[model samples]
Target: MKTFTSGWAFQKPDQNYFKKFIRLNNIAIDGIVYPKKILADIEGIPVLGFDDAHDIIQPDDLVLDVSTNPDLRKELEPFFAAKDIDCVSVPDYLDRLLSADQHDALLLPVAGIKASDIRKLKSAPIPDRFDAHFLDAESYEVASKLDGIFRHSQWQRLVEFDRDDPTGNVLFNVLLDLHARGLLKHLSA
Candidate 1:
């Protein structure tokens, strides 16, 4: 069996219906594990810092950090669907599955969001549509900072990993898993 894991520090806890879907499909999950210092409580869901999640991922589990680019989550939707992968949000618990050594998985970083078009938006006019979008100021700040780092350091890391292991499709696999579970709403055209 193959499984993929992903989590977004910004993803609302109430929006975790995807968890039930993955369980119904019997997919393995790897939730993002973070150090205590970076942890924050968001409506009761434990959110981790992007750097912390990246630093602690296990090699054997397919890990995903969605803090970098929310759109990347959309990009990955179809791929996870075709592959029939399972998704998980936590990483430490995922280590338990690694002990079996019977499954294949991918580890994805939330770093890819750096490559997204958010930079373009800085100069672009704010969409009239967002007037009613209710974005909190703090969320905006965190996302802006994360995007900057992802474009620089995180993007470099992902490129290096891909260059070293071209056969691995961590990003694609996670996208597919999200798609399969119908959790990939952002990607819908």
Candidate 2:
């Protein structure tokens, strides 16, 4: 039972590949500290939304391949090392992260919008319709801003498909199989 921890900053189109990988691998994941208002849905997947990764990570669990940001990696390295936990590189761990059951259903369309659009939405004023739908005033305000940005930005164009249309399961199983085979190694001892 390997537990995985990741950061919320990795929640983008290019990085969704890893998210789908983790979901398919059936790896229990935690330590994504995303704001609730920002998350569209997790679809009952086990997740912890906090302000920081340090809040959710324990010394015993493994930290998966994170963003390219060196500062964040540096901040987390000591924590994992102190706990005697294994920190695996993203490339090495990607396979195991994609080995979950293929029965999970897709919720949103298998496409991405632009980051500029998303940014625009995030900055936009909250509409009455959004305020009513979300119920929470704060959520409505935040969502409007996020919506604006997501709709306007070219960044959203980066999203990739998460499943095979025919099988309805994640398309990347070989990565997980490799991880299960002990081909993956820890970044820190």
In terms of lDDT, the best-performing candidate is: 2
Best by TM-score: 2
Would you estimate the TM-scores of all the predictions?
0.23, 0.36
lDDT (Cα, tens digit) per residue for candidate 2, span 24-67: 54555644423232453354434454334445556656666454
Q: Candidate 2, after superposition: displacement of residue 184 in Å? A: 54
TM-score of 1: 0.23
lDDT of 2 at 79: 57
In candidate 1, what are the lDDT values of residues 118-144, reduced to their tens digit?
Answer: 334334554342354437754554455
In candidate 1, what residue range of length 10 has the lowest lDDT sum? 106-115
